[model samples]
Target: MFYFLKQRFSHLAIPEKNAKRIGMFRTLCAIFGGLCVAYLGMTLLLFILPVSPGESLVIPLLFNTLAWALASLWIVLAPTRLRALWRSVLPTLCFAVLIVFFFFKESM
Candidate 1:
């Protein structure tokens, strides 16, 4: 099943390098990291701002969708840069999660 999907979307597959498994891991990390960053940013913003549940849900949904699109494009077009961006963004996301976890404990 996974192989079929990979064959169908072969353009998005990482190039055959010295370590194909490592390349695939890096690609997955970038896509997931981008999603995590977007979600964390929006989740924190939701807690800090005055927003209805419906509005809050929509905001994060849109951000995650956008991130997914960008991540897919990065995987197809610029795999190398994606790894660097993931590294830079992941820390910010972790910090955001910590802030939300600590400060918004009561509100959530």
Candidate 2:
């Protein structure tokens, strides 16, 4: 099974180990993590910066989209498999923490 998939995705430019098993999982993590980080970062910026409503809404959204793209690129280009996972996962954890904090704050 591994050998079959290894050769299958070689042409698609996916690494063997990645394509053989965990490629989809890695891709999902990177994509979703990037989105999560973007939202979290946007929220933080909105709270910290004293911008007008326009700037607050537009700038953060732009930055968030850019961050997502950059993060996805980083994951694909990382040299090691674990590095790719961690790069995505670490940001996700950050987002999770921020979300928890926001929820906790709201409950108070």
Candidate 3:
């Protein structure tokens, strides 16, 4: 059974072991990276919104799911595994910094 399966899919681009590792890496990146990006993106959205606190939470919360899906898709579709990680990391960091500054300004 295993032999027949191997022979059936032998023409795949990546070698067997490497492909499995890469697939796992991509999956991890998508899951964790998407969460980071989505959470940060939602907080960042708070700064842009002009509504009161009660109403403001609603929009970002609503958009969170959609943002997570898009971020996950973006990372998965990246040409290289590392690039997929970077695509998620860079924006997350940017959002973090912006949130920090917003809070700092509010404190001062």
Candidate 4:
């Protein structure tokens, strides 16, 4: 079954040397970039939830673990290395911007 799937998806496979590089790239993105995105996501969740502070904090705190896990897997399992990089980076950047905007808005 695995072999059949591999053959079926042969066009998606990377060369051996590039496989290692892409794997490392995905791993690094999953760890560092995913974490950044997850953390910011949690913060954004806290801000977005229409609940009291204590309840909101608890929800994102719980969600952070699941969010990080999903983000890591999402990055690592993307179709290509570039896709993985974007999957990790784009969300992180967007979340960072939203977090900044929320903070700035709060200050104003």
Worst 10 residues of 2 by lDDT: 11-20
C-alpha local distance difference test of each model = 0.60, 0.70, 0.80, 0.80
For candidate 1, lDDT tens digit of each residue in 9-103?
A: 56434444553344654566666665666566666666656767577777766777786666555543444544445564665667586766857
Q: Give the per-residue lDDT digits (tens) of candidate 2, residues 26-93.
A: 67767876777778777777655677656788788888888888878777666555566677778778
Kindly report which residue stretches of model 2 are placed more than 4 angstroms away from their true locations once superposed.
Answer: 1-22, 52-55, 98-108
Candidate 4 vs. true structure, TM-score:
0.74
Q: How big is the positional error of residue 46 in model 1, measured in Å on the Cα after superposition?
A: 1.5
Model 1, runs deviating above 4 Å:
1-22, 71-89, 92-95, 98-102, 105-108
lDDT of 2 at 98: 73
Query: Which window of ten consecutive residues has the lowest lDDT sum in model 1?
Result: 75-84
Q: lDDT tens string, model 3, 7-107?
A: 64453323435433557667788988999999998998887787876789999999999999999988876656667667878988999999999879878
**For model 3, which pairs clash?**
none
84: Cα error in model 2, Å: 2.0
lDDT of 4 by residue, 1-108 (tens): 999877745633443344445467678989887788889999998777888778789888888888899999888877676677778879988998998898798779
What are the per-model numbers of colliding residue pairs? 0, 0, 0, 0
TM-score of each: 0.48, 0.60, 0.77, 0.74
Cα displacement (Å) at residue 96, model 1: 3.6
Candidate 1 vs candidate 2: the lDDT winner is 2
Pairs with backbone N, CA or C atoms under 3 Å apart (clashes), candidate 4: none
